[model samples]
Target: MSTSFRMPSIVAALGLAGATLLCTAHAQIKVAMVMPTTGPLTQYGDMVKEGVTTAVEMANAAGGVGGKKIELVAIDDACEPKQGPVAANRVVNAKIGYVIGPVCSGASIAAAPIYNNEGVVVITPSATSPALTDGKNYQFIFRTIGRDDQQGPAAAKFIAEKAKPKKVAVLHDKQSYGQGIASSVRDDLKKAGINVALFEGINAGDSDYSAVITKLKGAGVDFVYYGGYHPEMGLLLRQAGEQGLKVRMMGPEGVGNPEVNAIAGPAVEGMLVTLPADFSANPRNAAVVAAFKDKKRNASGAFQLTSFAATQALLAGLKAVGDNPAKVAEYLHKSTIDTVLGPVSWNKQGDLNSFDFQVFQWHKDGGKSPAAK
Candidate 1:
């Protein structure tokens, strides 16, 4: 009788343990990362992923949010506008209540409506297009980074004051993000009474930018600003160098990729870019920076810390109000959360209340230093 009673008690204990394991599995809070997994812009996605993955892992090690482990699901949009809604639908279908990014501005703008309408809270770390939140009134969407307008002015200020070129030429890829920022820089430069010699659009994937380089040479511009990604910027720089149209070039953070170094070779050196302030240098972020170093990731990349901060804001809200997306969105709109980027709060339109866009001088070895004044 004693043996039989002990057997039943042991079985009951095993059953209870199994039930707890299942409960923990079901209690995980799923946050989807909407970004490019396959594309030329995959590096950008990888940078953001490093940040989100680190934040999630650190949070899980600390007992997770509201006693639930956070699960990150990657949904690829390929940084293409047409694929944005498709990626958003996949996240919605999987019932993920929070998202870390749709990395590029065009993709974010395309995906914003779906995320907002479905009550999913999306915080993009790298999309800087002003049109993403300009008139959308999107409560469920937010940004940890500044808009292109903000970055544009910072670049223009440095160009007008520090670089102080005699004739500036503005070029863009004619895409939404590139053109928008190029226009902003051009207008600001004009207002600052700098000569904007030429404003033109170039084909994005062209191999030869000699024609445009010829234009720059003919226009006698001393400085050029190209508002686009690194590929075109790299090509333009290489072709310009080859064609002997030697003008200093500058761009927004989109062109701040290491791949540009390979494309442009030594021509990439001295390239000026506007990027988010380096948060990895902050004393308050020492632990977080160490966490990144432990995983062999660089926390100083353009979107890494911003993405980490986006994850932090989301998790903080989840801790405060559980896994409800709408409540988290409301909380984010009203509350200031301390993140790796420091204290961050959002405006009614889901843009950050304030952000720092700094100038950096790119080196051929894929490192950046604060721009020399």
Candidate 2:
């Protein structure tokens, strides 16, 4: 009789514990981080992740959104266009309604349709291609960063007015982001009356850019604007230096990664690139900056604050409208949320109202300073 009574009590206790666990699980809101976890571009993903993670951590610490903790689910697309839809599907299948990034433009473009179609709200922090939203009319897809068209012109103006190169070579990686920005720079250069001697595409990931280096030397191009990431740019700089091609090089934000220092060595010292303006320097962001420092993360990187602002926008929507993705997206479309990037609002097409892109001179020690005039 005693044994039977004890067994029933134990069963009841176990049932109560299971119910509590289920309730706890359902109380948390999950946001998927769609970024490269594997591949050469993982550093970009890490930069974005740091920002998103910091925002989520701070929010959760401050009583969370709607009384529930925010959980991050990392889904790697390797920054490859082919893997974009796969990552999108993984997030969709898991029923996560929000996303922080598909960090690269090609992947973001490839994945935008799926996220929009599935009613998943995605805010990319670093994908800058204007082509991603030019004709898509995606209501659920948005960006915390400026478009490549905006960035391209900024780069071109600096090159035309500041660097004042005699003959320019505009090169791209043959990918959507690279080629699109390169075309923008090339066109703006023409309008600015800066001679573009060579407009070409270099196969990305090829170890031997020596062939192109040779062409650049032959073309008598005194300056180069490479619309690609650091890997190729690093190789170009290193190889160009080796081949005695003494032209100065510049690129978009994609080439600003510190890993370029390892690849280009002293050749990277004077490299110029356009990056999102430094927001960590803002006095209002002191606490946020301290938070980043406490965690040993750099708040001043190109994507960090943008990604944080993306999280803030998403969380603002969630806090306003609960977990309904449709309503949250609608709220985001209508509201300007205060974020690390200041008061930011998206236009009808889900791009920011305005973003400041600044030119910086990169150093061999992985530091950057305002570009000299």
Candidate 3:
């Protein structure tokens, strides 16, 4: 949809490329996976890797994409927005036709234009920033994950009706993903006529948040809604407990790591967080989950199943059109992909065809398990 490119060049290139080979080459299908395999988001990246690897194995066992095996090129982006351009460039330089992930929202937004311009198909599993796809209409970019706009309203509805706290406080890491969802939640809460006692942004990667806890306690906040990954939330939980604050805490899917419980200790008990419904719990995904656990990789996390679904859509498009990136993107845009996360389709903007979200409660005191209650 970008007017920047000459239509003649695209038509010429497609004609030349199509005329040379009507079908996929016998060479292996190389797909690039961009994520933070190291650094703060290492945990989330590991889950995505597991899901993509599992699905790749399944496809290969079935004779692969257009009779060619899949070869994944995993690259680390460290979840930094500044590193997104470089990570995207590495994938493009490798000449991958299809790509999955760039786990963080800021990183995904940064890398999207480059992928779109290069005519590569990218479907992110965990990048939930509204700005990432806003006005891009990038024919090549898509996401299996729903946006904060979908999740924030679900969370606000739950908090307003279920928790019914007298007052709420919203906090975020001030990064793109965190701030986007936090702002959505704030607006929804206001719409529900719930008084948001405080709406503030906090520093990310900080070890101590006693000052923030002190302010929350002084404000007499009944519940705190946070938007960030596990690390900072863990620190806040521990600090809030240390300061004898009794307010309940809630966050988005970014706060669902087991490491959060480890860091927060028992303080995370009874905390609430929203995620896409548990895909592993679906009987339709039994085979997929078994395949992953058989390989000693945990496929039990928020985005991994969505990642699997994205790869499934990618492969489906490949089978439908023989690995043509533009056609694959077109097919994905129009087709309803049956996946571990249920039937997934896409809009013209490359976002999900529908919105889905869920809520869970962390019971660290009860052996650090989520009850989904």
Candidate 4:
């Protein structure tokens, strides 16, 4: 669950411990990545790793954030909400100036207050619950990912306009991320006058969803929307297929990972997901994409570009005021930097200057596109 910031190329020079690298950079501002590199959400943690590492390499090669190479220190929180504060404590004790994650919503929530109190700037690439930015007390918490309020409307637009689903059932894992998104979707669907036949919460980490599937079948729902992670969604999709349920399934970015296909088998065919727009597809990002590919990493789907953007924001702010974490955070309140994701700006509440979400469809063996099937 521990990761080092030093890459192999710099390992021998920096004398990194074993395979894990921890090196110093010009700004003397070490940024930690708090994510789940173990447990059930390992795939998600890996995705975050790919993004952060690629961005760090690119920034370092480009003369670092501000004439200083960037260093990434990572710690695994297992995506558990309770582990969040523990991870934050490590980051604070390590004296890192900034942080880029707590990939899951619950974890992010748990860690935000601690980081804010410590005056550490934190930006999450994936956490997207409306509550994360509610009232905006923690000026340090920021998210490039769209909120559930935004994602819910997008999902509703797809269902009501594109799919024309007559009857639908909404399900969630009942976590902060899941329930918030589900509520948004529910509200949007209700506003659109779509019949949300059933609304239920299924226990996460349980392999059995047959009972829920039974309810779905009897509900005569034409579409099912699940607000949760890939594993639970995969199980539901696979079990639904086994039970001969012919309904369409949709979810938010939480289930968009490619690994979902492997877990669900062919049953994941045509699943719908809502996520931030494809940053790599933007012509302006061609250079960043090329840089990432040169380093043997996929710029697409890995939210690393956003992570890169977060790192850049942190570094740019730091240059304005040495390597002071508190001062850097205060400076981050008003700074714009160009990154792989897009031109970035942060509000005081730690929300992105922009709120954008896109609906994507996952094809079991074909393609996952921003557009619905």
Candidate 5:
């Protein structure tokens, strides 16, 4: 009789423990992060991850949206356009209603249609191609960064007015982000009454840009603007220096990674690039900056704060409309929420109402500051 009573009590205790575990498992809300986890751009992916992770931790600490924990599901697209749809399908299959990236513009453009068809909301922190939302009816797609068209003109004006190169050369990686921005800048330069001497395209993964460098030198190009990521830009910078070609190089935000220092060495100094205006220095973001610092993460990188804002937007939308993605999308379109990047609201095409993209001068010490006139 004693054994029977003890066995029943033990079974009851085990059953209660199992119930608690099940409840805990059911209380998590899933959000996907689609970015490159392995590739030349992995460092960029890590930055996005750091920002998203910090945002989710802070949200969970404050009690997550609708009283549930926020769970991150990271899907790697390798920043490849071909891998983008694959990652998007994985997120859809996981039943995730929200996403924080597809960081590269090419990947974002490739994945946008899939997310739209599934009614899943995706807000990219770094993809800047205007084609993502330009004249499209993508209700489920949005970005925290300014479009390349906007950035291209800013770069053009800076080059035309500030750098004032006698002959300009424009080069691109031929990918959507690279080609699109280069084309825009080229057009804007002409519009500003500046002549672009040489416009060219290069294959991205090629180890040699020496031929292009030779061409630029031959054309007497004093300033070269490259529309691509840092790997190619770093090679160009290093090679140009080695070949005794002295010319100024400028690029878009894609070339702003710190790893470029390792790739270009001292050649990286004076390289100009455009990035979203620094928001980490805002007085209102003191706490957020401290939180990143406490975790030993650099909050000042190109996409850190933008990724955090994207996560905040995701959480805010989820809190407002629960698990209904369509309603969440509608809420985001109509509401202006306070974020680390300041008050942000989206237009009908899912572009931010306003974003400030400014030029920064890179230093060999792996630091960048706003360019002085």
Candidate 6:
């Protein structure tokens, strides 16, 4: 009779264990990462993924949000505008309430509307085009990076004050991000009483920029600012050097990849590019930095800390108002989140209230430092 009684209790205990496991699975909060996992910008995507994953793991280790674990769902948009909406829909279909990327500006712009309509909160770590949030009151969209308009003025001021070039030329890839920033820098340079000798657009995938280099040389441009990705920028640098066009080249954050050195060879050295000031050196982020180092991940890349901060912002919103995307969006709009990037607050337009954009000089050794004034 004792054995019979024990058997029934054992069965009940097993049933309870099964139910607990089911509850644990159901209680997990899902967050999606939409970025390029394939294609030219894969390294940038890897940096963002590492940062987001590390931040989520750290959060989970600390008992998670409200005792529920956070689950990551990664979707590759290939950094292409055409693929962005497709990835956004995939996240929506999976019922994910938050997203940490769509790292490239073109992808983010394409995906923003889908996330907004579905009430899924999207916080892009690196997409900085002013068009993303300029006039759209996207309740579900936010960015950790500064807009191109803001970055443009910073670059323009630096050029005017430091480079002091008598003739400058502007080039772009004709995409939203590339063209918008080039235009902003052009306007700002003009406003600064600097002469912009040439402004043109180049096809992104073309292997040669010899024709463009000839134009720049003919224009007598001492300073060349190309608003595009590393691929074209690298080709331009290498080709310009081969053509004996001695000029200083600069670009926006899109061109701030270490891979540029491989493509441009020695020409990448001394190339100035604008990016967010490094935040990994902050003493407050020591623990986070150590965690990344322990995992063999770089916490100092262009998007790593910003992506971590984006995850933190999402988690903060979740903690404040539960997992509802709308509530989280409202919470984010009203609250200042203390994250790896330090305290951050968003304006009504879903852009950060302020972000420090600075210029860095790239080295052929795959390292970068603050540009000398």
Query: Between which residue pairs do clashes occur in model 1?
Result: none
The regions of model 5 sitting more than 4 angstroms off are 1-27
Q: 255-373, model 3: which lDDT tens digit per residue?
A: 98888888899999888988888888878777777777767766668888888988998999999998789999989988998888888898899989686787888877523344333
Compare candidates 4 and 5 on lDDT and give the better one: 5
Which residue ranges in model 1 land beyond 4 Å of their true spot? Answer: 1-27
TM-score of each: 0.93, 0.93, 0.91, 0.92, 0.92, 0.92
lDDT of 2 by residue, 91-148 (tens): 8877889999989999999999999999999999999998888878899999999999
lDDT of all predictions, in order shown?
0.88, 0.88, 0.82, 0.79, 0.87, 0.86
Per-residue lDDT of model 1, residues 116-198, tens digit only? 99999999999999999998889999999999989999999999999999999999999889999999999999999999989
What is the model-wide C-alpha lDDT for candidate 4?
0.79
lDDT by residue (106-178, candidate 4, tens digit) is 9998888898898878889888887877985787788766678878999998899999898999999999999
Clashes of 2: 0
Displacement of residue 148 (Cα, Å) in model 4 is 1.1
Give the C-alpha lDDT of model 2: 0.88
Alpha-carbon deviation at 242 in model 3, angstroms: 0.5
RMSD of 3: 8.7
Instruction: Report RMSD (Å) for each prediction in the order shown.
Output: 8.4, 8.4, 8.7, 4.0, 8.4, 8.4
Q: Is candidate 1 or candidate 3 better by TM-score?
A: 1
Residue 133 accuracy (lDDT) in model 1:
95
